[model samples]
Target: MQEIKERFKELRKELKLNQSEFGKRLAVSKDVISNIEIGRVQPKTLLIDAICDTFKVNKDWLVNGSGNMFNDSKENVELEELLYKISKENSSLYPTVLKLSQLDSESLVLIDSLLDKILKK
Candidate 1:
């Protein structure tokens, strides 16, 4: 299992937040964050949930290191789940989705416009 203190430190660093700033986001004092990070005290469940939700962290990964570090937004998670199901049903589509995932936002917008035009025909 992942140590909460270690994961808290990692999350703080990843977000480029100092203890004070991180604590502000969680509505806690800097001392509280410092204490949690140092293993001086366990954070409350509300604090843990706040950390996960506010930072888009995977609760399982934060708690047990059992999955991806970040959780996608609801829309993204839904889309990904749909794609996974589709990919399983039609394996060839998986590569296309993989390639699409590599495209930057601008490129994706261009592709979307082109696809819209094609579909309109």
Candidate 2:
């Protein structure tokens, strides 16, 4: 089993973020990040989520050290990070999208087509 220090070092480096900068994204102090990296602290669930999402880390791997650290490429990781941030602010978006999907095939296709068009432009 990897110690917290080794896991922390690998994760931060894989994300290409400095500890202080990563801490800022997770809304934690640098000292908190330092403590986690050096085995002085065990991060809570919320903090773990923040860190994992911000760095595109695999949650299971972080917790148990059993899988790849990151599951996405650099660009995809950044996009996922952005989406996670948006998720926090727009908690209703998922429910709204789900409701919209329950309408009809035509409505779903229309929405999907519209999104595709916008994405292509």
User: Would you list the C-alpha lDDT of every candidate in the order shown?
Assistant: 0.83, 0.79
Q: Model 2, range 29-78, lDDT digits (tens) per residue?
A: 88988998888888889987876766767888888887778767778886
Over 4 Å off, model 2: 78-121
lDDT of 1 by residue, 1-121 (tens): 5698999998888766799978987889999999988999998889989988777789988888778777976566446547756997899998899999999999999999999999999
Off by over 4 Å in 1: 73-121
Per-prediction backbone clash count: 0, 0
Q: After superposition, how far is residue 11 of candidate 2 from its true place, in Å?
A: 0.7
Could you report the Cα RMSD, in angstroms, for every candidate shown?
12.6, 5.5
TM-scores of the candidates are 0.58, 0.59
- Give candidate 2's error at residue 21 in angstroms: 0.3
lDDT of 1: 0.83
